[model samples]
Target: MRSKVLITGSSGKLGKRVLEFNEGLSFLSPSSKDLDITSETSVNKFLNQNSFNTIIHCAALARMMECEENPNKAFLINTQGTLNLVNKVRDIEKSCKTNIRFIYISTDGVYPCINGNYDEDSPTIPYNIYGWSKLGGETTVRSLENFCIIRTRFFDPLNIPFSESADDIITSSIEIDRLAKIINFLVKDEFNGVLNVGNEATTEFLRYISHKPNLKKCKRSDITKNLNFEIAKNASMNISLMKKILSS
Candidate 1:
């Protein structure tokens, strides 16, 4: 049977790219106005009315500085918001007696970046409010019988929003288009649990330069020193699993 997919956060960058790349697939990309995920009634209403076997959950208040300023709002949308969807999915699955594949877009920020090269088995110690909020969402998704929590860094290669990037800090960040492709693959795969998704460890500046050679370089402290909260120092992941999946 052809899978019917429902992609949340369709307006967002990653969500939009996912839709663009998977043009051949049967996808339902709804706006927040049409389906507000933070509202239980709204989510339940949408899910009940729509018939889909796959869910790509990408909705979250992911702004790091904003999350730091208002942690409660972060948790409300990220943590409680996810719980709302999970509850509805469980209900739908029970009533319909059909499997629903849930693909959650998580972050490498959940790792303790004090030491780099963390894997799926690594201890989760978030450095900032954004990280903590996402980690909360991941906790709820784990309860679902069929779910995949993808932990990775994602950045737009065409649109690097910053004039300068950190040279000192390292990450396993993947391009937005590639992220969309990989997630689509996972949606069809039998894989579950956390998968570290990204490229080899490289400085943010180096990754940024690949697309923007003229971009200026800066240290991590140069940016974080002005901020009140902490940022990931070296949140690079062991993406052997990601590579294995791609190769297969």
Candidate 2:
């Protein structure tokens, strides 16, 4: 039988790319107006009315500085919002007597930036409120029976918003379109648990230089020194686990 898929945050950067790449697949991409993950009544109503075997949850308040400014708002939307979805999914599965595959788009920010090359088994120590809130969501997803928590870093190659790229900061960041393709593959596979998805480790400047030739180079300290919250210098992840799964 064809899988029934529901993608939340479809209007987001990565979510938009996911929809563009998977044009052949039939997916229910609901706007925020149609479904709000933070609202239990809204999520329950949407789930009850629709029959989706898989849910790709990409909804979150993802701005780092914004999250730091208002931690309460971050938790309410990123952490509690995820719990709302999980609860409704649990209820739906119990009532329908069927399994639901949950695909959660997490971040590499969950790891301490001091140490790079993190794997799925690495200890999670978030440096900022954004990371902490996402980690909270991950914890709830981990408790679910059938779920895939993807810790990845991706940016749009064509539309990088930054005028200057950080030369000091490093990460295993992949192009948004590539990341979307990998996610598409994973959603159809029988994989569960956490996976770090990204390309080989590289500096932010090098990653964006090709796309933004005139992009100025700046140090991480230069940017973070003005900010109140701490920033991770090295948040690169080991993508061997993701490679193995995709290869197999």
Candidate 3:
């Protein structure tokens, strides 16, 4: 039988891409309006109605400024909301008596890199409520034995030109399409446990923005560092794990 994969936040950028790539596969993609992940009852009802072998959690309050301004909402959705789903999954799985793969989409913001690159084991210092909330969700997912927590760092394709800002710290990023492909691998249990995925090089925001000739340049100094805590001058990731996967 084909695997039934359920993806939350199907309306978002990454989720949309994942659905498009796996259009042929058995997928249950639902938007936030269709499913309230923050509500236990809603999650339970949805889980009960659907027989899914895999659940890809892509739902969360992710905008940095928004999360900072509304910390409560962030916690409710990113942290507690994730717990509700995990708990419901555990409960539903008992009667179903089938193994379910729980895939969590996490961010690289959890790491506090004010001066350098971060590895899988690097000390994580979430500089803002958004990061903290995501970390909280990650902790909840870790408690599950049959789960894959993937930490990704990338800016979605804005379609606009990348602006050059010298103060902008360089970080490893993956194109949305590329990241979707990697997630596809995980759906098949290809990798697990705190895997880091991104580009090998740490590219600056300005460099990326410059790729678009039509984009107007914004002064690096004009860009305000928007985080509660300080990070490394060069906070990037080591993509050896991703390299091994591609090679195999």
Best-fitting candidate, measured by lDDT?
Answer: 1
CA deviation > 4 Å runs, candidate 1? none
Per-residue lDDT over 1-248 for candidate 2, one digit per residue giving the tens place of the 0 to 100 score: 57678999999988888888774467999998789888888988888888878888998999999999999999988999999999988888888898999999999999997879999999999989999999999988887899999999898888889898798899999989898998888788899999999999989999999998999999998888899998879989999998899999
lDDT of 3 by residue, 27-134 (tens): 998767667998888887888887888888999887877888899999999999999988987887677777788999998888875655577888888877888999
Task: Report, for every candidate in turn, its global Cα lDDT versus the true structure.
Answer: 0.90, 0.90, 0.78
Of candidate 3, the 10-residue stretch with the lowest lDDT total is 159-168
TM-score for candidate 1 = 0.97
For candidate 2, the TM-score is 0.97
Please identify which of the two predictions, 1 or 3, would achieve the higher TM-score against the true structure: 1
Residue-level lDDT of model 1, residues 1-248, one tens digit each, is 67789999989988889988784478998898888888998999999899999999998898898999999999988899899999999998998998899999998989989789998999999989899999999999999999999998899888888899999999999998999999888888899899999999999999889899889999999998899999988989999988998898
Ranking by TM-score: 1, 2, 3
lDDT (Cα, 0-100) at 141 in candidate 3: 90
TM-score of each: 0.97, 0.97, 0.89
